[model samples]
Target: MPHFCRIVKSGIAAPLLAATLLLLPPAAQADHADWHHGLSLIDKLKYAPDFPHYDYVNPEAPKGGDVKLSTTGTFDTFNPVLDKGQPAVGLALVFDTLLKSADDEISTGYGLLAEGVSYPADISSATFRLRQEAKWADGKPVTPEDVVFSLDRSKELDPLYANYYKHVTSAEKTGERDVTFHFDQKNNRELPNILGQLQILPKHWWEGQGPDGKPRDITKTTLEPVMGSGPYKIAAFSAGASVRYELRDDYWGKSLNVNVGQNNFGSISYTFFGDRDVEFEAFRSGNSDYWLENIAARWATGYDFPAVKDGRVKRESLPNPLRATGVMQALVPNMRRAPFNDERVRQALNFTLDFEEMNRTVFYNAYTRVDSYFWNTDLASSGLPQDAELAILEEVKDKVPPEVFTAPYKNPVGGTPQAGRDNLRRAIALLKEAGFELKGNRMVEAKTGKPFSFEILLSSDTLERVALPYAQNLKKIGIDARVRTVDASQYTNRTRAFDYDMTWIVWAQTLSPGNEQLDYWGSRSATEQGSRNYAGIADPGVDALINKVIFAKDRDTLVAATKALDRVLLAHNYVVPLYYKRDMNIAYWDKFSRPAELPTYAIGFPTIWWSKNASPK
Candidate 1:
């Protein structure tokens, strides 16, 4: 989510999808179909009657060509646990999950590494059957031992590496190629998505000590590429530089159902660029074959290249369904900080935001305003409040006060800001009562005599442009605020330490949302090294609700707990929800093509990509 604006050197490559291919009508002057045109019919032939539902798994799929692909980031290491970017991309080619998320349905996985996922009816612990097919890049068989080693190391590793495995309680080897995972509880629909994130590593290769003579923390030792079971193994790696993943000619999972016709590219090489403009120029001139444009100006307009007119490059602007529809980017207040500790102050700050002006002027009309936590999607909360949430608010009306909920949450320009103003006025009164006063229009604490001025941090020029408008509005509300622009390197460190007063960022939630709802908004995650609590929240009630949702074994109970938590967060105004943009700006070469019809979920680039010809090596 932090990379929403910052250009990354890694991510899934958008498929070279050919959208809306022509299917000629029959009424063409009593047309006689020519032999050349008849071949097009063969292109749409069904070779397997039983497998008729397969979308892109054409047995006739042409092979033998090396598809050159490029993403924004480099895969500098082979250790799946250590490297987040390139390893994630590379793992897709080499390893297999216990269960495959095939077209939104859970399916029995083919054994490249795993044969099947076993769960008892009560579902407390699940066992994974490893295929004899699984092997390291060096051809050593992958076993249950490797699975156990990886999971154990992940749980014991430093916060940076362990954060991803926060919920996995423990992993154990039950047999040669069989492993069992004991969850803290049962019934998580996200089990499939979580499994997909795992990448099998070679346990034996990493067993030795490092140069320091101490047990190596796999994450920090980035000297070599990781040995994995994926289609490609690390060919070469340059620290903080470039990485090359060469195809494993003897790949174990080559013919698996989930991998069939996937990872077709012979090799993928990723190179990093500190400057996005430089990266865009490389993409235009063929130095870089692929890159996604984040600047709205480039997407709404056209690429400034001769190849576009010559038909060598194709650009498709499609709607993204997987992204968070409600607040992709948000303005979060630091609840741990004083003055902001009060609910009225937080609500007032949310009201003070002028999203309409920001969207139009700053974003160049590239975004839409979002009122609820879920912006444009069906998952976003409607105007109707959840019964439990409303009930909780009713009970707390006396102690913490209920105007925070009674006040109509409105966008200042479209709806009335009375609730916002009333809240702000109350904030002013409370501050005065707390022995603070408006000195020359800026709120100043009487005790410390410190002005209520804070800085907001962001990583991109685009965000800088948008944040300036929000800062100006805060200035009008007697708060002195300024936008702090930092390079990607500095920005990442500051955010990791929760170093800023206020920040603008987003989170990518899973489709079948789970207990991470707790991690994002719960009190326990507030101070963790890698927590998403940008607000520094520590409310016990919010924490209790989050835990309830996380441990809920039934869907209805999970939904009820989550909805209640969402309202509690809304009441606190820990985060000011911004608009979610439906349209995504994607630009690529026309030579790449994909199946005519795209899956509703895979409309974005990576899932739909296929190259018509090889890219420059």
Candidate 2:
């Protein structure tokens, strides 16, 4: 779960969980007495109630001109909340949440649509007072009724939101301009903050008929441009090829503190290409204005074009100051599948991955091995569990692997041929202990005499570079590992259905880990379709630990619980840990200008940026 502040991505769903408890501290009780301008999950907010704008933005920055961008896959829907189709990339620009997050803060939200929010110290419920000035794109005032409707509809329509807000029993319009959400539990501090992340929908527009006279359905994907309250509106679109958003002159909240210097582009367009290589060519030819390089090979040596050398283009490797770039991108073996269910077999798979060699050869030594699920963070497990973390792990000591206590988890090293051979030998031993033996050139199960073979499912041709090497390595151990590349749509559907033997899974972590942990590793999500549990992990110990992290009373306990969970996850060997780079590789044509100070957590593109050459109004 990427720490998406306001807008939820098209195919990727957000987080959710349920708990039952009641009791609020004195501090929480006092907070409910008066409405606050913002909410923070852990620390005090950096910005004061009357702060003019975020420090990262230029409040007087000029805004105009058009920007062209690119997306790898196609999109069929403008409706972002639906899970069925690929929603347009810039669809998030059209909506406004009750509260908006500041990029500099880890887990804090300032008032956006709402003027202020309040919750009792007991935290039984949170009440939000909507700003009378806030209006929909259709010019209708945003009401408490619309907020209530949006909450109810989201919980009813999307499984992701359903599970995320399961603890919230009801959302009702308690006053003319105020709406309250009642939670089933107390001390679950993240509830109010997470609720602030909700993208409020216009109840009237959703219930009304479309231009074709058919009733609009929020649950279904549609090509029709919907009404939104944000700065941009849908200008033009082709079903699956492209979409354009034009800034609205009558847009509400354009003068708000949060909106002071953001949404700079007069028009923003995104073109979709089937192949990444072709996309790069388009970018090189100046068809696109910006490109975020994810491929190391391209970043290392692919940007020697004439334009780059002539000063028309700029390439940079900016340091990512937001969150850890240590995402767990790896070969996730589906635990529901045979052989993968065995702990020893999973361990053998991890041993066969020669990341050290791959980093040198394929990645040009530009990456480092990811050792922890919470990699590059203080929350990651280190030398040994102690104090609070040890006490938490002790509760699950009997359930988790014993090595978690005795040793620090480490991936098998293999930079030299001799090291590779040694690692292969160790993998073979583990497989044999799991009741598998090599007969001739094939490895077969000892009891059933079944040959071991599986497909490494890939969504893009680029992944073949990584998968092919691993498959060749597996072949050396007498295991038939086939690499299959499917189209983007098919890959999305199949992965959502958990219909694969092995696939690349990237689980990005946030500094404030909370309910989202359940969606990533909880038992219930393991079997649930459209859930983020890509590996099908259903361990009871993992489930309990996730709960511990969620219901943690303070930041210290949350960190401890998260580290303990990390230790257990690494011991399981559920994934062949891949590699990550610390810096973000970015390249763009020098047509746009941005703030001197970038947001701590994000690039703040399009938003908080403007055209260097803008026409006077």
Clashes of each: 23, 4
Query: What TM-score, computed on C-alpha atoms, does each candidate reach?
Result: 0.79, 0.95
Give one digit per residue, the lDDT tens place, for model 1 in 1-617: 11111112112212211110011222221122111111011023222212322364432343333333343333334454542323424344444444333322211122235664445544455566677776776788888888877677755653433444565688888776667777666554344234434555567778866566766557564555555667776676566556666767788766665556555555566666555666677778776555565666566664757987786776766664344223435777777677667665666566667666555655667766766554454434445455755654454445333544556445445223564455456657755765667878787777877887888876655566567877776776578888887765566557667787778767544323454455566667677755566678788777766666555555455455555555566666777667655665556666555556554544523333445653432
Native-structure RMSD, model 1: 10.6
Worst 10 residues of 2 by lDDT: 11-20
Whole-model Cα lDDT per candidate? 0.54, 0.81
Top model number, TM-score = 2
Query: Which parts of model 1 are misplaced by more than 4 Å?
Result: 1-60, 63-79, 83-96, 103-112, 158-167, 186-196, 209-219, 302-304, 323-327, 386-408, 414-436, 551-557, 604-608, 614-617
**Residue-pair clashes, model 1:** 23
TM-score for candidate 1, residues paired by index: 0.79
Q: Which residue segments of model 2 deviate by more than 4 Å?
A: 1-32, 321-326
Error of 2 at 178 (Å): 1.1
lDDT of 2 by residue, 72-93 (tens): 7788888767767777878768
TM-score of candidate 2 against the unseen true structure: 0.95
